[model samples]
Target: MSIAETASPSLAEADRFRATLRNHPAGVVVITASVEGRPVGLTATSFTSVSLAPPLVSFYIAESSTTWPALRRAGEFGVQLLTEEQSDLADRFSRRGEDRFAAPTAWSRGPSQVPLLDGASAHLVCSRFDTRLIGDHWLVVGEVTRTLVLDDPRPPLVYHRGAFGGVSALR
Candidate 1:
């Protein structure tokens, strides 16, 4: 391969790629897992349902994420769907070295010892199915063990163009 073909990507190119993806709106979720009974989680917009018979779900996390280290040790995880009103919670979880569980963030430990945040549109308990490295991120697949749905009909949070938003009916 030519030197240019094998060369590292430019920062501008990476930025442009990110910007392009921002145009495609994605649902937001907070991936929670336990490390020695302590809860850890991070905001992710890449969560997606991958299968039915196997009851699989998937999400992507950056390889450099500090939380991923502990989360990997977790045999299972909790995927909580956030509502548009929970934007502050999403922002807090995205940051590093702070108490994400503290302040306004309400949550309780599940029977499996995973932290389940309050007010989520939906919640799912998942067994660590598998993980694969893709580019600079890890694609995590989880097998859903249990699921919950709230009676409240709140609009789930969506991320687009570098901001948080909710859905609206076109019809």
Candidate 2:
């Protein structure tokens, strides 16, 4: 622990830490995989590009996530970069024990059969590059083998301070 961490500890401090992180904006992402012949998915704001030369990206999943166990078994998955108009999808995918793909959730199988959600700003077909346990979450890095850029002109979905919003460029 850091010297400061060792000196004082309380739920107040944890709340402060959580709020501190919430203030930092993060791009929202959705992960999709076919587990045991069924589709599985979850929403996340932890996605980031890790490398350019090798085309790598990463996101973190909570260890307690009930969906992670099945998602891990799939050798491949799809990453969807959500647009501001897709918060409904983000909310749906974040929940547990529900049919996330139930009616009207437009999607189709990729060349490799990974379930890819339609209307995302971008879609990436990823194979496991690495996985590690960190704190209470799983850090997953994926090597992108294929990608698609949709022609949608909507702003990207962004999360900050517990709410979702879209970007407006500043002059």
Candidate 3:
């Protein structure tokens, strides 16, 4: 039988997709927001820089995420580029139904009033500009109101194949 014919279940298809993505490496980031004076954060890998002139950035969030609603209402958010030592932090943020900011983590207020994570390779404090519905996710566009390079020499944490990986050395 062909590969498609041999695939018996939808679960198998999902597994195959995930297996395919294992080869594609991605940088880790924490997307944070303040909800009713309480902070919330989640780990994300689907982030990118959109522009330079107006300093735009974009990231994707699952539509079903509870955090997104509060973040959307807040009208501002922070992006923390994780470093090699932040694998545990990434795991913490990736979990659901947990107190994300309960643990001690270094953070400082940015121009947008969002909490910019300390020890991040970089931090972007942004104002939510627009959002577009894209299938099961929301494509959130933000205007970078402030930017900071926390550690220019530090390597960022990377994720691949459902596991943490170290950043590649610069060429």
Candidate 4:
């Protein structure tokens, strides 16, 4: 189904749905985009793989976010799947108006010409596909054009129940 065709639940229902969703562990990701050669990044835990065959993914950003507007205009963006050791980076990106890339964080260019954080569990370089206004947020769909995966073993950074957690294999 198309994003615009999807109906959103009520506010209370959405809140309850989010509460239930918190129980499902998700890998943290930092979405990056460049506006006028200036880079902006934001930490998001709502990212998900939409399709492997078509190499598609989706993430949600609050409509109130100032960052999303720039990203939406950028046309292309990068998603950096954070590792456990990158919690500090995640915290930095999550903050507003901070120099996100200030400290010594390794980065490289993605297909979007956006900075993809190094040492991440994975990276997906995508072009904007479709966006839909869903209640208080926007559901952004992207078509992955390139990807990077680390060879080193590392756990993912996870956010749950308003707290941070570490990822682990489900064995």
C-alpha lDDT score of every prediction, in listed order: 0.91, 0.89, 0.85, 0.85
Q: Per-residue lDDT for 1-171 in model 4, tens only?
A: 765446444566779988998788778999998777878889998899899878899999999997887887878889998888898898889888788877676777766578988889888888888999998989999999888898884888888877888966789
* TM-score to native of every candidate shown: 0.92, 0.92, 0.87, 0.84
Better of 1 and 3 by TM-score: 1
Question: Per-residue lDDT for 1-171 in model 3, tens only?
Answer: 777676677678888888998889999999987767778788999999999988999999999997788877778888999999889889888888877676566677666568777788888888888899998999999999877886364788999888998967578
Clashing pairs in 2: none
Q: Pick the candidate with the highest lDDT.
A: 1
Identify the candidate with maximal TM-score: 1
RMSD of each: 2.7, 3.6, 3.4, 6.7
Order of candidates by TM-score, top first? 1, 2, 3, 4
Off by over 4 Å in 4: 1-21
Q: What is candidate 1's lDDT per residue for 1-171, written digit by digit as tens? A: 776765556656888888888799998899998889789999999899999999999999999999989998999999999998999999999999899998778999885988999999998999999999999999999999989889974998999898899999899
Error of 4 at 146 (Å): 0.4
* Clash list (residue pairs), candidate 4: none
Q: Which residue pairs in candidate 1 collide?
A: none
| Model 1 weakest 10-residue run by lDDT | 3-12
